[model samples]
Target: MLVLITYDVNTEDAAGRRRLRQIAKQCVNYGQRVQNSVFECLLDTAQCRSLQNKLCKLMDPERDSLRFYYLGKKYESKIEHFGCKQTYLPEDPMIL
Candidate 1:
């Protein structure tokens, strides 16, 4: 199956980006990160769970912010149902 994962980091600091990248690398060949904080992962149930665990570990306690969304579907599904629903929004402008 293919899974779509989206994540939002609470801050724009270097630490946040570094943590995000570290978590993403865990997926290796099973996933491809399509956006800065979003990743399109292809995996089975076991792989998904492993990825989730790794993501939780990458979070910083001081930040108090970590969020992830996962969407999964069988390989035979239509293309229309796959991919991101919206374009990436800049973190700066959205704050105001």
Candidate 2:
């Protein structure tokens, strides 16, 4: 499945800034970043749940926000992009 994850972290303090970096780090391990705070990850059910749990624990519910959009296996037809940033296929091979 394709999971679109977005987050908003309050970066008004040092701790918030740290959280933002930590959150971004975690996201990068699982997927590609589409925007400053948005990521597109291709993962199975178990992987998705595990990632979600990790993110939920790192986030400050009172000050941060998180969202996940499950696009299932057929995500090609579901996503449309028209922007300056280059788009990528989640299923394609990634050269690290």
Candidate 3:
């Protein structure tokens, strides 16, 4: 499945900033970043649950927001991109 993760963290304080970084780090481990606060991840149910748990722990519900868009196995036809950022296949090999 393709999971699109997006987050908004209140970076008005040091702690908030730290949380934001931690969240981004965790997201990076599971997928590729498509925008400053958006990520495109390809994960199975268990992996997605694990990552969701990790992210939930790293964010403060009162100060941060997180969203997950689940695009099932046939996600290719569901997404459309019209920006400068190149589109990528989540299932393809990532060199780095």
- TM-scores across all candidates? 0.57, 0.97, 0.97
How far off is model 1, as Cα RMSD? 9.9
Clashes of each: 0, 0, 0
User: Which stretches of candidate 1 lie above 4 Å from their native place?
Assistant: 11-14, 27-29, 61-96
- Tell me the TM-score of model 3: 0.97
Which tens-of-lDDT digit does each residue in 15-95 have in candidate 2? 999999999999999999999999999999999999999999999999999999999999999999998988889888978
How well is each residue in 34-91 modelled by candidate 1, as lDDT tens digits? Answer: 6665566667789888777777788776673545444446433333444665533222
Could you give the candidate ranking by lDDT, starting with the highest? 2, 3, 1
When summed lDDT is taken over every stretch of 10 residues in candidate 1, the lowest stretch is 87-96
Report the error of model 3 at residue 47, Å.
0.5
lDDT of every model, 2 decimals: 0.60, 0.96, 0.96
Candidate 3 runs further than 4 Å off: none
